[model samples]
Target: MNTDAALAALAALAHPTRLEAFRLLVQHEPEGLSTGQLVAASGLTQSTFSTHLAVLAKAGMVKSEKRGRQFIQRAEIDALKGLMLFLAKDCCQGRAELCEPLLAELACC
Candidate 1:
């Protein structure tokens, strides 16, 4: 991710509602969540949820699909990972070993 992308992602997640919605989408993974379901889960009104979703979609933090009358939203895990990678891309200027722990943490998958 570039600086702009990272900033957008951070801005999208800056709101509490959007943060929780993204977490819900992440937990649901590929299955995602429909508009009504997201509203129910988040305890937000439809209008409120839509605004948050719009911000996330604009920032590339969320993906949405039309399923009949409902819009299903999914967390953009790759984009989020890219942002994290971009932030740490430089690592230690002269000490590669300093990043061993950070790299090790991502070894889970």
Candidate 2:
């Protein structure tokens, strides 16, 4: 991805609450979570969670779908992988094994 997109994604995840919400959504993958679930999980207020969700959606890190009366927010995994690649594109002069553990976690999500 381009530098600006990367910066926006990183910025969207920079905050503690936002990062936690994003990570939770990432971990949940396609299933995602409702606003109330995210609010409880992040311990954030409704307005705060809405703001963070908007930021993430604008960054293309997440997408929201309405299911009945509630909205389900899900992480865009491909976009998240792009962010990870941007951050790790240049790492370890040699011995990529040093970063293997970090990369290994990618498979978990």
Candidate 3:
């Protein structure tokens, strides 16, 4: 991702609630979760949770789709991957050996 996009994603995830929601969505993956489910999990009012979701959407870190009468929210894995790559693009300052350990840890995940 470009610097601006990376910054936006970072800013969106910087909030505790947003980060937690994003991680939760990631755990759900392709199937995603309904808006009500997310609000209940967050223990927040629907409107409050919606604001957080909006931030994530603006950052392209999350997406929602209309499913029947409800909206299903899903984490944007590509956006996350881009953000991660942007952050690690210069890992170990071009020293492959120095970055091997970090890559190994990521591979485990």
The lDDT values for all models are: 0.89, 0.88, 0.95
Structural similarity to truth (TM-score) of each candidate: 0.86, 0.83, 0.96
What TM-score, to 2 decimals, does candidate 3 have? 0.96
Candidate with better lDDT, 1 vs 3: 3
Worst 10-residue lDDT window for candidate 3 reads 89-98
* 2 or 3, greater by lDDT: 3
Candidate 2 lDDT over 44-77, as tens digits, reads: 7899789988999999999999999999999999
Segments of candidate 3 deviating more than 4 angstroms: none
Off by over 4 Å in 1: none
Per-residue lDDT of model 1, residues 6-98, tens digit only: 999999999999999998998999989988888998898899889999999999999988988878888999997898888888887779898
> How many residue pairs in model 1 have overlapping backbones?
0
